[model samples]
Structures are given as structure tokens and as C-alpha cells.
Target chain A: MISNRLFIRLLAFAALVAVIAAIFWSQNPAFLSGGNIRALMRHMSVQGLAALGLTFVIVVRHFDLSFPGVASMGAMTLGWLIASGAPFPAAIAGALAVGLVFGLVNGIAVARFGLPDIVTTIATGGLAVGFSYFYSNGTSISQNFFMSGILDLNDKRIIGLDMPFAILMAAAGVAAVVLHASRVGAGMYATGQNRVSARFAGIATRRLIVLAFALCGTMACLAITLLVASSGAANVTAGGQLLMPAFAAVYLGAALFGRPSVGATLAGTLMMSTMLNGFTLLAIPYYYSDAIVSTVLIAAIAIFDPRLSGLLNFRKAAA
Target chain B: MSALTADIPQRRRGADFLMRYAFFILVAVVFVAFAILRPTFVTPGNIHGMLMSASIAGLMFLGLTWLIAAGEIDVSFMSVAALANMVTAALVQDGQGWALASLGGLGAGVAFGLVNASLVAGLRLPALVITIATGALAASIAAAIGLGTSIALNNTGFVGQVLGLRVGVLPLIAVIVAGLYAVSWFVQERLTFGHYIYAMEQNRAAVVEAGVPVNRMLFMLFVLSGVVSSLAGVLLAANLSSGQPYLGTSYFLDGLTAVLLGGMALKLGKPNVLGTLAATIFLIGLLNGAALLGWTDSQRQIVRGSLLLVGVGLVVFARSRRKT
Candidate 1:
């Protein structure tokens, strides 16, 4: 039954995307050019990776406000290490480690100590950003860093797709399989749906939550690596702007899928990236685009809940 | 059974006492530590600065206490304040009187508050999500209305001179903060509205079933929050002598920190105005002390962030322990 609904939604979304694409193409032929398409894909891939991690946390009915902090810290860590003559692999490993530790702290605070997820993540995120700023001395790192490997990886295309795009797609495929086909995935969904029943049914709900957070942290690290490599520098505010779009994508995915899923999230991410690219081509200011996206997100959430829609009707009737 | 019941009440009373006085004790400790570490911390000038800092945050905290007690949250108050400040400053820059311009700013805040109230109360959407959208929207509107980034206020105006006024050794803003706190205390502790707020937080269904207009009350509370926060923004602009688009960005976090650090429970509807005031003062003192000790802004932020985490953790832990 869920799959049937999912299939219908996916088809509808695809149709909508095509219509939007046509509109953009009419406005500017360059919107569909090969170079522009590749650039759009790269942008979508960066956002998708973060949204993918967020998908894991949100599926379990939790919010992780720490992703921006984690990404910035990871990027700064990598940049600082590479600038200090550290090996590329070592820098990557260090960044990953930082992400894992931060994720673990958040998971423990929420799952074990029963702290509110949003509050805990917000605090941890602030700490993470602070550390990044302190480490970078409040300046963007633009020193000589080992970029040959990253540049080469990005350049390596397969079947006319950027390497980063391929990696993101592969990640989404694996996530879909795990979520739809694996036992642990079932446990996670059950935990989110009803904790008491899941516990009664012998699921280690706390452990599942912790694992979800860990995966989220690791994914953030990978996303930041791509960002730093592509930009060849790390700024104190580097991952701060990704939070809103990532969140909108995650919720939109849930609205479409009737639940959170990586595939749905990737679709949502692509739609957003495409819309943003089109908006840019049309010379619309960034703020207007943000306002529109947030409105859509709120509307999507409202539409997904039958109760909320019913309440809206009742309000109208009263008025 | 009788003995167990008696013992439970006694234990609960003891816990309540500790919760009430914990913040005060923490404030004293912070004061002493700073005094010992930094020779200039106890000076009259630094003390005045700390009080002045507390006034703005304290006013916002007053509004937050009411909303949190009613089981709602508004993260957009800061944005509303920023928008209000910009409006007031822009009007003043256009040669309008300070009284009319400040009123205009407050009106803008009330307008935004109504939008929030309609969405949150009428539509039943989560307060957090709706407020986040409104906040972003408010910021965009502020930027669009020619308030681009920052604008210098006309310092020769009444708004500027009044905010800068001091009563001998005390700032006028501090007196306003004190007056606001007294009114809030009266509203929370003396009025039937306060009773309704607590009742709603404890059990919304019960309050609604008991003939209370829950939605209307919530709408009013949000408007009150908006008005107070905007007033803070106005005073902030007057103090800085410039209107900044991002001035209120840090207030949301700082307000939350003060509220939680003041021993307000996240799960319970307990309002602690005194504790909140003390927490604000403690936070300012800590920041001033850090400056005196020659710590960088990054280091101070790290300390503040960690303190927020620990403070919230302690409150949550205490609440859970009491439940057990």
C-alpha cells in the first residue's frame, strides 16, 4: 500500500519537474545546456549528501540541528590539517573522527539522557561552530592544500555524470535498499512509529537511534570534504547556509513518500536545486527564493497531515 | 500509607526549594569567581555595564516565560525585534517624531505576531516550524524595505537621548527592565490569566474543556511577546545609535540560555522571572570577566555554548530525577 502511494507521488513529481524545466528552458536556453546541467548536478549532490544524513535522524522522529556545525568543523579540521603539512588521508580521517565524536555526544544526550533532541543538537552545534572558529582563528583558510586528488576525483566522470553525482546516487541507492529491505531499517521505523510497541516487540530502540545519529555524523563529514575540495578553502561560515534547504528537502521528501526515505529526499533535493538554479537564471534575488522555498515546505507539511487540513477547513467554516 | 504520603510531600517541598534557589546560588558563585579572577570585575563601571546588558535580554525573557509556560515557543521574536527596530529607525531617519516611530516599530511587531498567531493557533502547526519561516520572511522584508544591512539613527532625536539617559548611577533602561519584570510577575502570579497559562501547560485538554479560550489566549501571548521583543530592539538601536539588520540574531539563543539557566523546566510550566533576571546578570558578568581575562570572542562563545549545554542538562536531569 505504501509503495503504491510512493509510486504515484514519484510520477507526479517527475511531471512537475519536467514542466519547471520547460519553463526555465523557455526563459534561458542555457538552463538545459550540458555545462549548466553538470553544475546543477554537483550542487544537488552536495546538498543531497547532507539531506541523506538528516533523513536518517528525521525518520526516527528526531531533529539534528548540529549538521551545519558538524560540516563546518569537519571542513575546518581538514583545511587546518592539510595546511599544516599533514597527509591528505590523515586530514580526512581526522575530520571524520571529529564528526563521529560530535554525533555520538548528540546521540547519547538525546537517546540515553532523554534530553530534547532539538535543544541538545542546537547546543552541540553551537559548540562545534565555536571550535571551528577558534581553530581557524576566525579566518577563512586559503593556504596551499593538497587538492590534486580531490580535483581529479571530481573530474573523473562516468557515463556523462560527475563523480560526485555518481557517489551521491550510489549512496542513495544503498540507503533505499537498507531502509526498505533490511531488518534494522524495520526496527528504526517501528521505533519512530511507536516506541512502547517497538520495545515490547524486542527492538533495541536506543541503540538504533544512536546508530542513526552516527551515520548522520559520518555523512556530514563526507559532505564537508567535497565542499572544501571543490572550493579549495574553508570559511568559518562554510556550511551554515545548508541547514534550511536540507531541512526543507527532508520534510518535503517525507510529505511525498508518506514517510522519510533517502530516495524521496534525493528527489526533493534535486527539485530544490533545480528551482534555485532556475531562479538564479531569471535574476531573482536569493531572499525571494528562500521565502518561496520555506513557504513550500510549510505547505507540504500541512498538506501531508489530514488532521491539519481538516483543522484548516474547520477554521474556514468558523470564519 | 499515611506515612508514605507525608514523606512524599516533604521531599517534594525540599526539591521545590532547591529549584527556586539554585539559580540565585549559581549567580553568587559566578560573581565571586569573577571578582577573584579579575580585579576590575567589581568596579562600578563594569557593574553598570552588566546591568545594562541584562535589561534587553531580561525584557525578552519575560515574554518567553509566559509563552513557555503555555507550552509554546517562538524562535522568531528576535527577527521580529530586528524588523521593528529597522522600521523605527527608518521612520526616525525620515524626520518622524521618536514617539510615533517607536509606535510604528511596535505596530510592525504586533502585525508579525498576528501572522504567527493565526498560523500557530488557528492552523495548529508546530510553533517552532512556523516561527522559523516567519523569521526568515521578516528578515527578507527588512532587507527589502531599504534597511539594507545597517543604518545610522539620528542621534539628535528623543529616542537616542532618552535611551542614553541615566539616573545618577543607574540607567533608565534598567529601570524599565525592572518595571517590566514587576508587571510580568503580577500577571503570572496574581491574575487569573496566569492560572490559565499554568493550567494549559499542565493539561491543554482540561483547560479547553473547562471553558477557557485557549486559542485566543495563545494569540494574545504571542502578540505580547512580539511587542516586548520589539521594544527591546528599539532600545537596542537607541543604545547602539544604529539600526542593524542582524542585531537580534544572538538574542534568541541568549534568551533561551537565560530562561533555562534560571531553573525553568522544559517539561513543566514553571515560570521563574527572578531566576531569569539573575541568569541574565550572570551571563553578562561571565562575558565581561572573559573580556577582562583577555579571552578571544571565540573562546567566550565556546564557554557560553558549553555552559548552555550543561545548564540545560542539569535541569532535565533534575526533572527526571524528581519524576522517578
Candidate 2:
């Protein structure tokens, strides 16, 4: 279903990546080293999962701005449980439980109460972040972090792939099946495209929306759990830094595929992470990556949509 | 009269009264409650500080409320404020006068507004995401200009002193903001442009059919918000005596909360100047009281966040009830 214009845009994106990569490669030959490549892949894992979760939410025409806050909540809840000498498995369950509860709260608020997603999620996100801070007393929790062997998940390999990427791919696999191959997936797409029509056509649009948010929240926690395992610490704000990048990746994916998709989101995440890694290789200032991401997001929005033939001709085309 | 006849109208009257004045009641209750709890809260110094904050916050609210009233949004005001902060401070550091420097800052705000208007109104993209991108870009550009740090300003300029000056119990900035609101109130309550803007929100197609310049109105609202937010940025810079790239996210949260809180009162789920003024007072009082009461950061945030959720929820609830 992807058009020729999308195809050209994808090629143009590839060329842009290559050109940027070539510039970084010239500055530092180590930019293309195996170590860097592996590191970039590792970096992509959490963001990949974030984008994957977001794809489903976007497919249902809902925005979940609360994921980072939910991630923070999950990671901190796990940290709190583990610190109190709870069983490792139980702590993981507790963290996942936090995600599900918050997800459901967000879902009910938006889908059931008919609240606007933007402000409602911001409120939920604030509550999540607040709870996280209250747990850690606004500091990083690391007292029992070392004793918990969950850090092994970061180092261990599964099926010859790094543990994080393996986990990411597995989640992506499930998401792909559910979003593309299942009957519910069809309902979600239709609901997003035209909610009134979908409702008239006998789809449980509200239920599907709540489900998307619930899945999104749970998957965000799963990704953040890996981050905590990899880093051996949980803080109040680490997950927040991922929100904008996750959004950019989702937009890039939508722009590429002409619709939100799990696979395209994964690809978008990988592309963004690679460019970010390249920026790091070039020793650019840290915040510059955000500048690049923001610029790319704007460019993608302006140029990629097939509705507008050119930038300045927007009114004419829209008319 | 029978109990049923009297009680029914009384109950209905009670709700109607609440629907009209709940915001003012809330403001009065919060003010009195805080005054009773914290003796220091009612002091002139603290009151001055609160009013000063409310003034700058009021500017932010004015900008956001205009867009929101028109059924558009600008979440990037914080970023634009940061850019204006940097531009003003950087120009000052380059030995430029304050007037010129402030103009440079406001120009930055205008630039962001124009970009936002073009992307949103002209290209028909979603305002939320477009502004998010532009906000990030503005903040980053501000960071680049400041080398990812704060540039210090002395706050010695006459305008800064005037802004900081106190007229009895009132801060001068509060007077400025109130004057600006008075002007906005005129435009909103008396102007055909204002009616067109609101009509566009309620029914864009009908407005287009009527042959009003809806796109032009949208552009004007965007630019108007941009300029107002930039003004807030300059005022904030004056208060802080510095230009900072690394501003906290609280301003954005606070602005949204105040504006949305205002959505519940005066105009019944619509953004209005009077509702926002009362809401801003309540919001500023809450934060000020929280500080004086020694609440933790998390505690304050939790309360504020809940208020936002509840406020927006009430607005939705009111709308649905009206519909039914």
C-alpha cells in the first residue's frame, strides 16, 4: 500500500543517513566499529520497544504521553520492592502491575470518561512521576540494586542475540501478530481511520482504545525494566528523556509506511538511534541530538505527507 | 408550599449558583484557608512575590488562552520563552542596549510563532506535534546560543527596574499584565474578530460558508500568542536577572493548569479572561502556600497534577451534562 512517493522518501532517508554516517566516519574511523554498532543496537532496544508500543496506540488514534512517567513508575516500583528484600520475580510482577494499573487509569480516563488525551495523559504522567519521586525521595535508588541479579538480563544472550535486543524483537514479534494478523487489529485500524463509521459498523471502538493504552503502558514498563537492569539503577527522570525521541520515531514510522506499523516503528527507532550514535561519535554536545531529532521530525512532517505536493503550496492543496 | 416544590427549585438554584461562581468560591476558599494555616502567607512581602509570579504566569496564560479559545494550542511557549531569554541576554552581553536586546528576544518569539502558524494553519498539520517539534528546536537553538548554559543579566536596565518596582502592595509587572488583559478583554468582548474566532472553533465550515477569513484569524491568533509568550519570557528574564537555556518544565505545567483551571469558571468550560484571572490567583496562592507550608517537591507536584486532571475532568463533565 506504500506509494511511490513513500518509496522515494524512504530512499532519501537512507541516503540522508548514509551521508550523515559518512561525515561522522571521516571524523572518527571508530564511528563504524563493531563496538559502536553493537552499542547503537543496544541503545535502540528500549526506544524500539517504546515506539512499538506507541504504534498500537497511534493505530487506535490515541496518544499516550504517559509512557515515560509509567516507565518511571514501573522502574521505581521494582526498585522499591527489591530494596525491601522482596523476591526478584515478585518485584518484576509488582513493576508490571504498576504499569497495568496506570495504563488502565489512563485508558478509562480517555476512552471512558471522554477526556482529551493530551492533558489527561499529562496529568497521569505527572502523578506517575510524583509517585516515583515519593518512593526514591527524589533520588536514585541503588541500595539493593547490585544484589538483584536481574542485571544479568543486560549481559546474557538469547538465541545468539544480545539479551535486550532479543527481548525487544520478541515483543515486536507479538505486537506484529496482534496488530497486523489478528481480527482485533483490523478493528483498531478502522477505528483510528474513522471512529464514527467503525462504531456504526459494530466495532467496540472504546474497548479497543482502552486495550491499546493498556498494552502501551505494559510494554513501556517492559522496555524500562531492561534499562534499569542494564544500568543497575533507577531514577525519577531517566525515562522522561526518551519521550520526545519515541514520538519522533513514531512520526517517522508513520511518515514512512503511510500508516503506523510495528515493523516501521522498529526501523524508525533504529535509524534515529544510529544517527544519535553517530552524533555521539562525533563528540557533539549532548543536547544537539535533540536539535537533530526535532529538525528531522519537522522535515519529515513537512515533506513526507502525500497530501501536500510542496511546502508553500499547502493552502492550495488543502483547499 | 409542599416540601417537593420548594426543595426542587432550591436545589436547582444551588447548582446554578455553583455553575456560575464555583471558580470564585474556590479562589476565596483557598485564600482564606491558606491565610488561616500559614500566618506568613498573608504578609505583604510574600503577597508581592506571589503577585509578581502571577503577573508573568498571567502573560503565559493570556497567550495560551487566546489559542485555546480559538480551538488551537501552543505548548511551545516555554521553549519560545527560553529562546527569547537567550536572545535578550546574549545581545546584552554583546553590549547592546536593553530595548534593542528585548526586541531581538521578542523577534525570536515572532519567528517561532510564524513557523508554528505556517506549519499548523498553512500546511494543515496538527498543532500539538508541530509545536512540540518547534519548541524543542527553539530550546535547542537557545542552548546553542548560550553554549548550553545560562547567560547572566544584571537587571539594571530601567525597564527591568520599572517591571520590578512596587506600587504599594502591587508589583509593577502585575499592573502591566492587568493592562494587557484589559486590552485583550476589549478585543474579545467587543470585536468582530473575536466573534469570528470563537465561531471558527464552534463551526469552521459554517464560518467558511459565511465567507469570514478563518485562516487569517487563525494566523493572527498564533502570532498573538507568540508575541505574548515572548513578552512573558522577557518579563521572566527581568525577574531572574539572567537568560537561562535550562528552564524547568514546571512553567509549562503551571501554565496549562492555570488555563485549564480557568476553563471551569466564568464562561462555563470556555477560555475567558475573567476566568483565567481568578484561576491564576488561586493557582499562585496554592503554590505560594505550598512553599510556605514546606511541602516537598513531589507533594506539590502531586497536588498540582491532580488539580489539572480534575479541572479538565470537570470541564468535560459540564459539557456532557449540558449536551444531555
Candidate 3:
């Protein structure tokens, strides 16, 4: 069974890589082109920024459904600040502050009220979207000269890859070190594994949960910046479509990286994005594209926990 | 002795009746407030429209209440409903009779529900996760086979008319919904399965110790939910005269809101079917009234989502209080 699990993940990875290679070969005939790889990496970086925060939330067994709302709020607020003649650094800081407040509200709701994660987040998500819509007045934010400097992060490459790609890699590294190499990360895992036990162990489970939300909100804030720089527009619906892909990445990370690891989440984001990019390049039908993602998600669930596949003879609750 | 016994039963009956009906009174108060705000809101025709609007979805909630009360979720119902609609539509298009279409839709619903139950019961997977995955899978499969477009029923014939007709100014769907509530109430309050479902919900380990096939009971609950949901979908297809993949999304919030709002406490073991039916009407009334008051679509979504949040909060609070 262990071998079977490994083989399936390996197949998933191999398939992802093969699809990318095929797309590259068909489009440019220069499969190893530096510019193309850099471009892909640049896109991956923006997606990674948001996916990283989502990883923190999901690993702790709570989903941040309000992520898109937070992201849109941050992005539009940043654009508004920049448009009002703020410096780049100040605009970014202001955006992060907005995210922080939203995160705090979510933390208070979940920790103090003991609300169900799904209920609280779904409500907060709509609230955030509503706030964003009201704030933006149902229009996309305009680009500014200051925003142009932020966009340059995608254009500059170190050696053959873009700086944004490197930044994404560095962010993943930090997440890994914090989660696996630190006490706080252990506390998060403890809290998620069993709240009652974690509280008994003096883990300050509530605070750690709050910290997880803050991290998620911060990451989403940063991702909004990157998204704005890349797409040059901050519409209300900009962050909505990313939810599915973000969720897909987290689940894929669990399947690929040995359960909810930050590194796994990062890898999953890249893999999912690459799949979409390659499929589009290959001229696959839209419905088929959806089919592929759904199939992979289910396959991952079945493979990651074989007993959960319902193939065993006893047919009893084992997991 | 006969007089004393009669008094005792009368007192208990009064309390039970109040416990069952207090929530409906609360709804009536809200309805009065809305009617006062908008004079036309309480009109007979508008009230009938509201009942028709909620009937199909309210019926689905009747089934879902049992599954949720069993401490398991079946989010796959909407997707299964979509599949059932598409299959029935396809059958009808292929020159099959209406009865066959309805049967096909219901049978497929049960089969899919069985699949969901098997996943949750046999595999020990989390019900929420399993249902979500399978739901998406089912939806994708349906879309793939749906001829790459939405299907509209052009010919009514006898089957369509019977399913679609109104009975004494009330939609047939509304009658079916009332019938479903009665059946669900009987099964939950009077049947043996109801006892087992409650036992499992309260303490599954104890139920297993008693050598009851807990998995089978839970599985059957999901199957029941699926079959009922498909029936709802067929009724919907007749009413709307079309089938589309995206049509089921709204029902997710609708059914969830009704079940939660109708005093269906999590700790109560099984949900109140009659209460759920009333709550369904409440929601329908609120939406229709909001529309008449000139609220925009986005405002409607915001209202619905917020109302659901409040309902969930109430349930959580009630459950905690009962514990105290």
C-alpha cells in the first residue's frame, strides 16, 4: 500500500511535468527557452503568494473562505493609496494593515465565539466582498506610476529566472522553517491535531489559531499586490476564481508533500497552475480542463488515504 | 383515577404542542412585520407564489434534515439532482414516457446517494469531504454528457402537465412538499429507523456495541436524501422547463438555511420536518417581499448569506443552552 501511494504521487508529478514540456515544445519549439520558463515562474509566484497563506489556514484545519475578499480589499486599497500619491512602501504597508484588521475580526469570531470554521469564514467572506464592492464602487482600480515599480518585480530576472519566482521560493523556505523547524509551528500542528489536548499542554491554542489567521491574511495581502501588478486591474471578482485553484493546491500539497506541508502547498500551486497553463496552450476544451482538475483532486484523496477509498473488505470505519 | 390520568396526559400534550409550534409563531410575527411594511406582501396570490417558490426546495430539506441529524452531511444532493434532471431530460428527448423519466431520475438519485453513503460509511472518510468531491465529480460528468448546452423541455404532454399543473390555485409541487413533510415526520418520530438514527448521532460507539449496522443506517440516510433531492429536481425542471448545471448552487444555501433556521438543534438528534417546512416558507416570503421592495440581486445574496449566518448562530446557542 505504501508503495502504491508513492507510485501514484510520482505519476501525478510526472504527468504534470510531461504536460508542461509538451506545451513548450508545441508552442515555441525551444523547450528550454529561458524567457518562457521565467514567464511561467512569474505567474506561479503571484499565485504562490495567496496559496501560501491558504496553506497555513488549511493545515490548521480551518479554511479561510474570506481570502478573496481580503485580497480584493488589500489590492484595491493599495491602488487607492497609490493613486492618492502615496509611496510604494507606504501603500503596501497600508494594504497589509487592512488585511490585519480583517484577520483580527476573523480570529475573534472563531476563537471567542467558537463559531464553526465554515460558517464564520463563509459569512466573513461575503462581508469582505461587500466591503470591497462598496469601497471600489463597482469599478476596477487604475494603475499608477508607483504601481509600475511594484510590477517590475515580475520583469527582473536573476540569472535566467524572474525575481518574483525567487521571492516565492524564499517565502516557501521561510514557511517550511517556521512550520517544521520552530516551536510555534509545532504548536500549530498540536492545536489542529486536537484542540483539547493542545490546551492541556499549555500551547495557547487560541492565540496560535489567531496567529494562523494573521499569517493567512498577510499572505493574501501580499498576493493581492502581486496580482494587481501582474493583471493591472483590481475588480471585485478578481479574487473569486482563485478559490478553487487555491483549494486544489492545498489538497494536492497534502497528497504530494506528505500531508499539509508548506513546501507541498507551494509545489501544488505550481503544479496546478502549470496544468492550467499547459492545457490552455494545448487547446483543450474548457469542460475537459475542469474534468482533469476534478479527477486529479479525487484521485489524490483516494490515493493519500487508501483505506478511505472504500476498497477494503471489512467495510468498517477505520480512519 | 380516570380523571387524574386524563389531566396528566392533557398537561403533557399542551407542553409538547407548544414546543412543536412556538417557532411557527415566531415566523408569523416576522411575516406580520413584513406585511405591515409592504401592504401587498400578505395578499393571497403573493403568499401562494411564495409557497410554490419554496415547495420543491423545502421538500429536499425534509430529507436532508434526517441525514444531518444523523451527524453526517450529504452535500452531493444538488449535484445528484442535476444529474437526475439531465438523465430524465435525455430519456424524454429519446421518446421515453414521462413516468420512465421520473423513475429514472429517482433511481439514479438513490444510486448516487448509495455511492456517497458507501464512501462515508465503508471508507470512514469525512462525510463533508467525500460528498464535496463526489458532488463535483458528478456535476462534471453531467456537464460532459449534457450535449454541451442547456436542455429545455419543448413538449409538455400528459406527464409534464400532471407534474406541472396547479391544484385549486396551489401548485402540485406544494402538495407534494406537504406530503413529504408528513412522511418525513412519521418516519422520524414513529419508525424504528428513527430510533437507530438518534442513537447513532448521540453515541455511535454505543450503537456499534449494540451490534447495530450503524454504517448501513447512515448509508440509507444519504440514499433517502438523494432520492428526495432528485424528485425536487424533476419538479423544478417541470416548473422551469429547463435544466442547467449552475441551477443547483442556490439550493445549497436554501436547504441549509431552512434546516438550520427551523429550530433544528444539532443536539436534538433529528431535525423538525414541520418546522423546516415553515422556515422554508419564511425564506421564500422574505425573498419575494425583498424583491417587491426593489432590493437588487446583490442585496438579495447578502441578505440570504447573513440570514444563514444568524440561523447558524441561533442553533449553536440553543444547543449550548440545552447542555447547560
Q: Pick the candidate with the highest lDDT.
A: 2
**Tens digit per residue, CA lDDT, model 2, A61-173:** 88888899989989898888888888778888888888888888888899899998978988898888888887868888866777777777788887888899998889999
Q: Which stretches of candidate 3 lie over 4 Å from their true place?
A: A1-43, A68-99, A136-160, A163-167, A306-319, B1-26, B87-111, B145-149, B157-159, B263-271, B314-324
Note the Cα lDDT for every prediction shown.
Answer: 0.79, 0.82, 0.72
Please give me the total number of clashing residue pairs in predicted model 3. Answer: 0
Better of 1 and 3 by DockQ: 1
TM-scores of the candidates are 0.90, 0.94, 0.83
Give the candidate number with the greatest TM-score.
2
- Residue ranges of candidate 1 with Cα displaced over 4 Å: A1-4, A146-148, A308-319, B1-20, B146-148, B190-192, B264-271
- Predictions: Cα RMSD each: 3.5, 3.7, 5.5
lDDT of 2 by residue, B1-324 (tens): 366436555665577468768778877888888899998999988888888888888887787887877777788888888888888889888888889988998999999889998888888787877888888888888898888889887653766888768777688788878898898888887898777767877888999899997888788778877888887777777778888886636677777777767866766667777678777878788888988888887887788789778877877886786555
Q: lDDT tens digits, residues A1-319, model 1?
A: 8778668778988997899899999999999999889888888888898899888888788888888888899889988888887777888898888888888989988899988786678788888888998676879886765443545446678877798898788888888877778988898899889988999999999988987888788788877877777787877788787777788788777776667888779878988899888888788777677767777777777776668656777999999
Off by over 4 Å in 2: A1-13, A309-319, B1-13
Q: Which residue pairs in candidate 3 collide?
A: none
lDDT of 1 at A137: 86
RMSD (CA, angstroms), candidate 3 = 5.5
